[model samples]
Target: MGYVLRVRMASFFAGAATASCIGLSVLYKDYKTPHESISLQAKAFHDSLDTRISTLESLRQSEAPQLPQTTTD
Candidate 1:
């Protein structure tokens, strides 16, 4: 009957929605990372960049000056 078909369709939709919600919940729970780990990684990256910048700055500061030379015209 038409009524039975409608009930079956409604049930299928309800089950699908429930499964979707559960799948999302599990995904969020499994993929959550601690803030401390993120902060540590960021700090390490910042320190490395700082070291590189300082080395480059020191190299620039210590470069030899160019000398004037006579050129053939």
Candidate 2:
């Protein structure tokens, strides 16, 4: 009975280790892709947004009305 229990425990540990390795490998593969990560996507979005904001700011500045100065006598 003791031998059987030891074998069962060993088998369980082996299975768990295998499952963990496979899961880690899958995760590594997924994270290896640039677009697969949320952080990368968020960074790309933030960069694009920054670009758009700068463009809009430049356009607004260009279109703004200039006030003329009056000379006092």
Candidate 3:
């Protein structure tokens, strides 16, 4: 059998954020341009996407109907 790799997107995004913290720290410490503004835009975009994904999940759950369970003797 060949090698197989399985990746979870949530984990990937979380790893990206963790890695970015180190780089962002350095940039923030010495940033003198409009980097903060650009960063804010990027963060806002990410936040919106995360919120939408969560909202969709909640809506899906609420919309799905549950059937009554029948007990068998």
Candidate 4:
């Protein structure tokens, strides 16, 4: 009788662990963005940053003040 009880308890624990694993896997899939989506998002962000940086550089160059050089005779 004791051996049978032990076996049943072990079986119950095993089932619970399996269920937990499956639940976690499903939740992870649902909550996490796919790698491809993340990659595309990051690429778009960097592209926008690049465009802003280029515009700023061009504006800086256009607005730069020219200094006159004095020649000593």
TM-score: model 4 vs. ground truth: 0.61
| Model 2 C-alpha lDDT per residue in residues 46-68, reported as the tens digit of each score | 99999999999999999999989
Kindly list the per-residue Cα lDDT of model 3 for residues 4-61, writing each as its tens digit: 2234666778899999998899787777457777888999999999999999999999
Models 1 onward score TM values of 0.47, 0.51, 0.46, 0.61
- Candidate 1 error regions (>4 Å): 34-73
Candidate 4 residue-wise lDDT at 67: 80
The all-Cα superposition gives candidate 4 an RMSD in Å to the true structure of 3.1
* Number of the top TM-score candidate: 4
Model 3 ranges off by over 4 Å: 1-31
Each prediction's RMSD to truth? 5.3, 3.7, 23.4, 3.1
The C-alpha lDDT values of all candidates are: 0.90, 0.93, 0.85, 0.94
Compared with the true structure, model 3 gives a TM-score of 0.46
lDDT for 14 in candidate 2 is 100
Order candidates by TM-score, high to low: 4, 2, 1, 3
* Candidate 2 Cα misplacement greater than 4 A, ranges: 1-36, 71-73
Provide backbone clash counts, one per model. 0, 0, 0, 0
Candidate 4 lDDT over 1-55, as tens digits, reads 9999999999999999999999999988876768668989999999999999999
lDDT of 1 by residue, 34-68 (tens): 55678889999999999999999989888967679
lDDT order, best first, reads 4, 2, 1, 3
Minimal lDDT window, size 10, model 4: 28-37
